[model samples]
Target: MTQPIPPQKIIVHQLGRDYKSATRIVDDILQDPKPGQIRLRNHFAGVNGLFDAMAMQGAIGYIPLTPPFDLGVEAVGLIDAVGEGVKMSVGDAVATTGLGGAYRHYQIIEAAKAYKIPTATPDYLAIVPTGISALVALEQVAMLQAGETVVITAAAGGLGHIWVQLAVNMGCRVIGIAGSDAKCEFVTSLGAERCINYKTNSVADVLGEHYKDAIDVAVDTVGGSIFDALIDNIAPLGRLVVSGYASEIVEGAKPVLAPRIYERLYWKGASVRGFMNALLSEHHRDAATRLFDMMHAGDLHISLDPTVFKGLQALPDAAHHMMSGQNIGKTVLDLRDGV
Candidate 1:
């Protein structure tokens, strides 16, 4: 094989209190892979709005870094340089997830952090980090069971859509809540038993009239009023999984008067649990394996937004687009041409 070359990368020269001002594209020289590291030619990088925003504002408590740091957490690529002691070889396809290595055309990553994949495609961006979150959160945290009824907020989104399909495949009846009629239709097409247009209809009223005391598991990414409504409608021993607070993340958390958690949950023996995929890193490999298997078996489908962002320069705009809630599915930055 021919020798691989270094590539350009995105850097945060100064932290933007918001997404737009945070990042800049720059030419970067990739260092040769160190011992136990493998260099990758990144094909596509995943855009996670919440993480991008928090990372820009220096709110990522777990992996603190000063300015002039790289951004992005996940990507799919082919190995171009394998360092001494690394078992991977040139041209091997892989998916890697770690902070600060993805938004570049080429990445030098620890071999242990990279997983061999069947193909270097943008789809793996959905299957690895995003899909695994759905799998682990529902299976491990919520302990979702077959034949139960699940209600998912933001159910037409990247993560929520995966959850809807997974729940349906597990023999669960799913009620999906989306913001628009188009999104509701999309969620319904994913096999949700019902797709509620939360913008047009009252979630609480609909649940109260038709699904009151019947939701066995509630997965909420949008918090605020939607979360409170789910809390009020959970069945006996139901599990409420709090995966994110997208609403609060963008609009800021607002105060609302609602029944206390003790009042809403204690009477039914139900429980509310919060899940962060980062906290369940140990299971990521297994979860990714399972999700890929499902995808290959035609039991899983990934949705990508119609608009595609290209090159490191598009990162900030992509983040802003996602935060604006205009994306129907996963927002991806395509770097296959190394732009």
Candidate 2:
């Protein structure tokens, strides 16, 4: 006779910042009903900006959680038990991402979307690609060509840094636009040929002289003013990739691109494309594996700096630190560290 599966302890965590009041509330959800999904003991989970935004808008309804909807989007865990049809073994290490509900000690995951973390690869590195979705979008969706001049705004960010390295490795001359000197240096360290601290440099003066004609591709990770600044500088036949806006969540803070910008783009024979990485499928991931291979070979370095947070209870503070851009690398809440 087959043995019955064992029950496991699971804790889900989340935080919501009120849209108007900006008050933050975090809670640990108990998912002990032992639902019909693969039970996993989470090892490391990383925070994301999208979760923070959703929290601010009070849009946590879509996410599946026990009581408090878990806010994390990606995590690495070990499979402890499986529901009826799951194929994973009891001790297999896997990483689940995208469908929300991470931040936990143990949780259930649908079978198909879970990825097995290779024995040689660390779980933290496996989680990197999932969180840097924008980088994947900029590289794959855009079909960025080599030897072109590419511009990336907010170049110091998690997604932006990967985009810079990916573009550079593709043989593109990258120009990074960052808010501070430290951010500029960060981009430069990632191999961006030119780093412009937008706060200090005149966009027009810098681009007109350096690029000569215009930027071949503009990967705008920062929306609002930075997006506005790139409109006139984009080259003829250039592709403008808008992937995110981290400017301000205070509502009406990030103004949409004006109609005139589209008109200008049309006149210049350029195209503006909006991308969401969630739309990428397994085939797209196969293509990105080439980039990842490069990363592993050191031809394109894309590892996140390890920032360890204490425990599940401290997720609120870590989330705030992430939102504030205080954490340099991926802030991983080590589930086993305290357990």
For model 2 the TM-score comes to 0.79
TM for every model, in the order presented, reads 0.94, 0.79
Give the C-alpha miss distance for residue 251 in model 1, angstroms. 5.1
Model 1 residue 311 CA deviation (Å) reads 1.2
Per TM-score, the best of the predicted structures is 1
- lDDT, candidates in the order shown: 0.88, 0.64
Clashing pairs in 2: none
lDDT of 2 by residue, 1-339 (tens): 545333222223333343224332343343532344676777777666555565545554444334234356677778877777677777888777754446556677776666665541333443345434645576666668888889987677666777787788778999998777887888888888889988888876788787744788888866776766677778888888887666654353554545766677887888888876656664544644565566557665544546666556566666677666665545566666544
lDDT of 1 by residue, 1-339 (tens): 545444788777788766457777778886799999999999999998798777877777577878989889999999999999998899999999988889999899999989899899888888779999999999899999999999999888889889999999999999999988998999999999899998899999999898899999999999888888898899999999999998887445777676557988888999999899998999999998899899999999999988889877787788777777677878899987633
lDDT of 2 at 162: 71
Backbone collision tally, model 2: 0
